[model samples]
Target chain A: GAGVSQSPRYKVAKRGQDVALRCDPISGHVSLFWYQQALGQGPEFLTYFQNEAQLDKSGLPSDRFFAERPEGSVSTLKIQRTQQEDSAVYLCASRSGAGTDTQYFGPGTRLTVL
Target chain B: TQLLEQSPQFLSIQEGENLTVYCNSSSVFSSLQWYRQEPGEGPVLLVTVVTGGEVKKLKRLTFQFGDARKDSSLHITAAQPGDTGLYLCAGHNAGNNRKLIWGLGTSLAVNP
Candidate 1:
C-alpha cells in the first residue's frame, strides 16, 4: 500500500516569495495534521483537519500561513510572502480514526528561505 | 500549558550498547507515543502507551508510561547502527486529544 507522500521534497524560496507545500494522505484516512519542524527540533503542530473541515488552526504562527483541504483528500500548506523564519520542514500526517490512533507521516517538504 | 522535556538531547554509543531515553512532564496525558525519524524523513511511530504504568516492547525497544501518566521512557537494548536517528516523544492531552505536545527529542548515534 502507498503511504502518505509530499510533493517537492525540497523547496528553496527567496525571501518575500510565496510557496505551497502539498501532502497526499493515505486513502480513506479521515484526520490530517500539519506540523513544522525546525532543524534539530521536534515538530510543532500547525493545523489539523478532519475530513474536509478544518478543525484546528491555532498552531499556525501567523496570518501568512494558510492551509486548505478543499476536497478532503489532498492538503496544501501555503505560506505567503515567505520569510527567513518560515524556513523549516513541513510534515503532514494522517490517522485512520480518532485522535488517539496512530498517525502515518509523509516524507515532508523541506522549505528553505534564502 | 503542557510541556514535555526530554533528557540527554544527544547520545553517541557503540553498537550492542544499551540506552534509555526519558520524557517527563507536569501535566497528565491520555496517551503517549514514541517515534523514530531518519534524516530527510518524517517520524515513524514506534509504540503508543495508553495505560498508566504500562509497558510495551517492540523487538529491542521498550516503552513505558508513567503511573501518573505524566511521563514515559524508551529503552533500547543492544542498540545497532541502524537505530541511529532522532527519537521523539509526543503526548496527547485529555483536553485536546487531536493535538500532540512534543518534546525537544533525543538524537542518538550508534556506531558499529
Candidate 2:
C-alpha cells in the first residue's frame, strides 16, 4: 500500500463489549507502534513491534488491552470488556528501521464506548 | 520516565502574525522530530534535528534545537491559515531503543 492503513475508521460499542482494531503497515516496514489518544490529549504509546517480535508492551495500560503482530505486516489491538475510559482514538504507526527513523501513521480508528 | 513539556497548549492568531511554540525536557535526546496534524488525520513529519544547536528552516517555518539538546522550538513567520494545526515534538533517548517520548501538542489556529 502507499501508506499505513487501518480498519474500521469508526466503532461504537457498548460498555463491556469487546472490539478489535486492525492496522496494515507500509509494505516491508520493520517497526510498528500502537498508541492511544484521549480527547484533547496527545497520543500515548501502547506497544511496539520489530517484525514479528513484540519487544515493548510496557505502555499497555492494563490487562484488558492487548496487541499482536503475528505475521509482521499487519497488527491487531483488542480490547476486552471495554469501558468508558477505553473510548479514544487508536493510532498505528510504522517506521522503516530503528534509531530516529521517520514514522508513517495510519488515519486511526475512533472508538466510542457508549 | 522521560517527559517532554510543551508550552501554549492552544494559540489563535490572525494571518500574517508570527508565533513560536516551545518544547522542553530535562533529559537530553539523541534526536528530536516535529509533526503537524490536522483534524481526522495522522500527524505528518515536519522536521528532525539531531545535533545540538541545529537550526532548520522550511519556507516560512523555522525550527531550532537547544544547545543542550534538551529543548526545541518551532517558529512560524507571517503565519497563514494553512499553518493551523496541532504541532507535536518527539524525542528519542540516547540509546538503541527507538521509542519516542512525546510532548503534549500545541494547537495553533491562524485565522484569516
Candidate with maximal lDDT: 1
Best by DockQ: 1
Q: Which pairs clash in model 1?
A: none
Q: After superposition, how far is residue B89 of candidate 2 from its true place, in Å?
A: 0.5
Residues B21-42 of candidate 1: C-alpha lDDT, one tens digit per residue = 9999999999999999999999
DockQ score of candidate 1?
0.86
Which portions of model 2 show Cα errors greater than 4 Å?
A: none
Give the poorly placed runs of model 1, Cα more than 4 Å off: none
User: What local lDDT score does residue B15 receive in model 2, on the 0 to 100 scale?
Assistant: 99
Quality of candidate 2's docking, in CAPRI categories?
A: medium
Per-residue lDDT value at A77 in model 2 = 98
Per-model TM-score versus the true fold: 0.98, 0.98
The lDDT, on a scale of 0 to 1, for candidate 1 is 0.95
